[model samples]
Target: MTNAEQPETPLDAVRALRAEFGIDAGRVDQIGRLLTGGDFRTVEEVVSLTGTSRRTVEAVFRALEPDLESSGDGRRVQEGRAAEYRCLFGAREPFGVRDPWTDDARRDPAAVAAMAGLIGAAPPPVQALDHVPATAETVVKRARFMLDGFDLTGAHVLFVGDHDLTSLGLFVAGGAPGLRASVVDVDERLLEFVGAEAARRGWDVRCHFADLRLGLPAALRESCELVFTDPPYTPEGVQLFVARGLQGLRDHRNGRVLLAYGFGERQPALGLAVQKALNPLHLAYEAMLPGFNRYAGAQAVGGAAALYVLRPTRRTAGAARAAADDTRTAMYTHGAQSVEASGGLDAQAAARVLELGADAGEKTLLVGDGWPADAPGRRIALPAFLGAPLPRNLQDHGTALVNLYPGFGASAVRALLAANAHRVGLVCRNDLPLLKDAEGQREFAGLVAPKFRIVRRLRDTPGPGQALVLAERAEPEGDAERVLGYMYARAHGKLGNAWREGLIAARKAAGTTLTKSEGRRAIEASASRPDLLERSLMELPLYLFAVLEGDVRRSVDALPG
Candidate 1:
């Protein structure tokens, strides 16, 4: 049939389709334009032009089929390249329209009666003062998942922040049977809103108004097991919130603090600063909630937000004592040597001994009278004879015992070995009584027995003017030239001519033949190569010796062998 001769489609049918499907006004105009152009003669054409799936097009047509009239043969046919299903007459009457939110529309008696008939009377109030009502079902679902991991029964949970849309919604979604959930906010308006909502739902909720910046209320001290805090969006606000939140938990026995904050590339420095502040406090971050801004809205500004779970510091008095004891045990079992005052084995002497050990594939210990505050090695501090037990965390790292002494005792030596008995190469020299006593000897033997193969020697007296000793428990695997190159780089200018001379004397006494110039060249070459210096120092042999001798200071001075 000709286009003008075809039956007119009523406007009513089109309007009904638009209202029922919630199609945008602009999309409806586009459909009208297509119809005027005679482009929507078939269902397939409508689907193709609308960019909607076939099933959706069919559904739309089905909804409007009753309002449409058929014309021509009223047959479904296949065109040359396109498929067609015909809807004959156009729309006629327009559909009714009303505002979605007007009180009349929302509370219309007829509408309320119909709804009541369908679902029965409104759901019972779960609580007394429900402030915020929840709408987004997905949010509730995700929150339920987070709560699954926690045991909230009988727990005092505090939500701190402004009671906005999200807070209110969360209150409703998370309010469980027998769970006490309270909201704390500085703004009274938000609290009132929450209180009203709770009252509507018959929910029993407590509202507290306080300036979080000033610190938590004294009443909450040690009472909260979980504090959920979403701070203001600003960095300053975040910092203040974290500080105050942490302080609030000082008296908590097993309390946890949850913080929510926004972060972004533009303010990476702020995030790093927060991390620095939290690290010393030993707080660990558990999980992050991204895209929280949808609910936080403008409060979240533009960046992403994350949730951090923090707990109190984990370090204990016993751990500190154990660490100290370990240092002493390491020193005695490794046989740290004391540099004789007349030997002139200063820092330069210690550095050279480290180099010689590196070159000879042996480990050496240079026990000084005082700690090298900037020394590059493991540091062990020994205080009093048997101060607190050594820290519990100290572990044997194959070689090295850099002992620092405030004052020493036989217990220091025992603690050092007890902590690092597995390490190889024992270089111990102390003014304290040697492990000459039977009990001391047995303890030393027990520590060294399993790892004695790495120990180069038992005890060797140094020659006059010789401030250090190069003990070879095991020969390193490599060309002497390369080994010397590594040591030279590590020692840098720290190894002076005097130290090299002492090394030559020590090696000569050990029955190794080498010229003074060769020894000097080897030391100089190693010191010059930066790459070899660090690597050589870390090797099994050099690492053990350097760590032990370089770190020994006055801490072990009073320690009994």
Candidate 2:
């Protein structure tokens, strides 16, 4: 057909309306070209094109009225009916859409086993998170399906949240070569676990610590082709995480976001509310596979949730810009238990705080509980509980201690170590002065007796809780301290199981007759407090003496008998 014969199109109509409304000709031209190309022009796009604020974009849409319908709660206003619209860039169904997991992907026994192991190694789920991680089989299926459906071979994938270990499953499945996977999470334990496992497997994976509510890391913004997230099962949580994932898309034109969200049948309204929340983000809903994710223990949703494949439109970009400053910290199912919750101490936790804070003398005590009365030096409350971001003051403190209490474990330990405290201690409840059982002794040895000395062990004659002190051993002196600092810094301040292997390697290289078990014991003894600074002060000296003492035999001789 000749240009003259061409019918007045949506773009032509937009142009006519633009002239009638006296909108900027250049802005109208930009909008016409984009919409004619079958794209959604969001408030963000119009603002960027015309150099205006969101209010102006809203005014333009309102002026257009029925001619251009606003989608995603008005963030994305399009020329056609909402049902006919796909994405801001163009309309395209998700390529290679398939049932959850292909048979071939699920048949690999080794991959399945590896998935199980990874899931087992993940940090224990926080009940407050409503975290019932999917079964290993479910996780393997989800990974396989996502990789295949998304064609993620050799792609740089970003995981906004990874409690399910889907990213690890992708690495283990092994079909996607040269895959560069990265994770950003508030949980330090998850970051540590993923980092160690990735290093062990030699996969190109990097772990970062971030709180989504605070915005994404600047380095990761617009840096990935795909983003996968299984956000908290709340409308606010879903929108925040999904929006963050969308922001991480390197190229919004072709980038995709895979979202896992589910609501109970009885709570259809809740599910609808969640779906509606996506309107502001302006993601093109490509396809949704209901009950695609199967959890092992989430009875609230009948152990399953749907998977959503979303492609970003220009509207998505605009929504992200507008919502960036509007997002809040409490976007979880349990507001009080959310990672943003300020950890305040109860009476028992407070009592232990007094004991831990009693000898702070000229040192900062970053306690989970606020300022203990008569506490020495300065006392500050830190959000050191499960899922909370590590306090910024951790690096400033000389000594850090967490009074062992219910609902606190390795996660707390990880936070203390990450703080870079020079000395770290774990105050316990058991009577350390009279403990004798081998099993009991082993647990205490893991914390105090060996690497840490009993600075104070007291029970005020049937007091409410036992008070036992385990301070960091004095820093190494001379060459030993220098070498120790170098090695610990190289290890990044956390002594995980990998450090044990490294210690064993150092021992063998020194020609030491140290058994692997002995080397393991030494590493464990050095890690009693598990704080990098604490471990360096105590064990790195011995490690350096074994590895760097000039002559191999001399190095072996140098290790304490």
Candidate 3:
């Protein structure tokens, strides 16, 4: 192709090269960028630097043979054509010479450069979650801004949703190695990816799973000092994420929430609506840097966003607590929760779900978003049902009619496990992907297994788009099993309360009369904290859940026989 017809960006070139040469174009791009990056990178250095396989690096060298040269120590683009190769390879300085917020003191050049190279390795945006990946430069700038503007030393930092990998960028931009950083995300893939990178790099970052629409992780509430978020570009999404961020702070008055938001230039009203929504939370606008964030995509808003520095007024504590968005599903602007995402249950759908549980002949308890105005049973929001502490009276729960869909997303597994009743039936769209295939069904069953024996009695039964999943509680089979059942049955109650009661009951049933005091002491000696005591069992991240499970089993075994 003529020079005029050539691709403008290296990513464009990578796409063309891959289509033409059937090569690992992504690695080729990275290798090319490294070779012309003003440094002689040895094959080994390139592999170490980019996490590109050694074999792939050598293959790229062979492909770029005509443009390459070598010295005794390393490789580079031939000096005479170095500049030409640099452009073709997409090599560019991470920080432009004209930028003002950046300085060596605030961010390390090498760390930021390395971060830029690795940023693309993150998983692509999942639209249902309203993910929009930011440019590496934007990510680095955000980190720099935080460091220059705040006292993050030994601070508990939170990334409300880190599909952009800003948590990694923070450390790259000089965050302390011991900085207590936590990332909460609904995507299991993202949590695993971020956790793996943190572990491999020894960055001291923790990843937890939570769909903010459901609720923030119980352990994270009121525990962090600074929160950074890039939420869905919708008013409800912005408000919900900011509210959750505010809730995470140890004291709202002293903490800050760094937000990235933007709207189309032609849609000023949309921006104003979001700003008005923030007013209710009583946050003071500390700073507004327009066009501060640049994205890799999201061109509808001009491929850029604004950075907002928000400080919580003391009154923000109450406002933030009261700001949970009831229309959870409608927050995401695309995919499952797109335009038709209201999640308002019609009389027919709600009644269908109720009919499945009607055989139980028990009182109904409504859980989650949207039930008809006249639907039976008292209400507990899905978020509260899944994560908040609830009454411990398991006997009072006759039949639980839950909403497992619409805005619910991946929390469906945990939601089903959270509801305790002899029979629980939930309403969701007919095409719920989890029950569509054999593999998904098997996986779903495995997760909630031993707790509930689930069966999908209806998928498209009521009409063109509807499904019903019914589960019955399983019988506890062992001492440990019984204790787990005891605790889980009252999943709405305080974890410590249920555990203590279950431990004491387990010992008594095993021919020993362990007192509540003894059970409590044993649990505390096991390193259980008051925060853990107040949390619901279903509210913990999976790792913490496993840890608590082990703790409870040990407590049961420790009880005198």
Residue by residue across 1-561, what tens digits does model 2's lDDT show? 477844365434444545644523443434433434445566555444433334434544654454564455333435354333222224332212356374655688788788888888788986655667876766777777766777776788999888988888887776486678878776656777886788787777767666565566555678899999999977778888888887788889988898988765446798898888788898889989876777765555656678899989878887976666454545665534364564434555555655554354536554444335654544433332222334564445566665433223222223333334456655443443224345744444343222233354444311344333345643433433333333433332333443444455554555655556764455544432232322221122121223332322232234455
Off by over 4 Å in 1: 1-142, 165-171, 247-254, 299-303, 314-561
Error of 2 at 475 (Å): 1.4
Model 3, span 252-319: residue lDDT tens? 76889999998754468989989998999998999888667776656566566778999998789889
lDDT of 1 by residue, 1-561 (tens): 376643354344455555655634333433343344433345545433443334444544553454433345231222321111123223432211222222332333443333233222223221111112221332333234335546766666666653332333434445455565566654444555555565566655555544442234434434555666656444444444555455444334466677755444234676776566445445556554443322312221232244566665564222322322222112110122121112223455345444433333323222324424444444443332112223444332334433222122222222333233233222334333333355655444433222232233233222222322122122223233223322322321232343345345445555665566665554554442221222211111211233322222111121122
Model 2: per-residue Cα lDDT at residue 547: 30
Q: Name the runs in model 3 displaced over 4 angstroms.
A: 1-109, 113-121, 199-204, 325-327, 339-343, 369-376, 387-395, 430-433, 490-501, 513-536, 542-561
Arranged by lDDT with the best first, the candidates are 3, 2, 1
Query: What TM-score does model 2 achieve against the real structure?
Result: 0.50
Best candidate according to TM-score: 3
Clashes of each: 64, 2, 2
lDDT comparison, 1 vs 2, better candidate: 2
Q: How does candidate 3 fare on TM-score? A: 0.72
- The C-alpha lDDT values of all candidates are 0.38, 0.57, 0.73
Predicted model with the maximum lDDT: 3
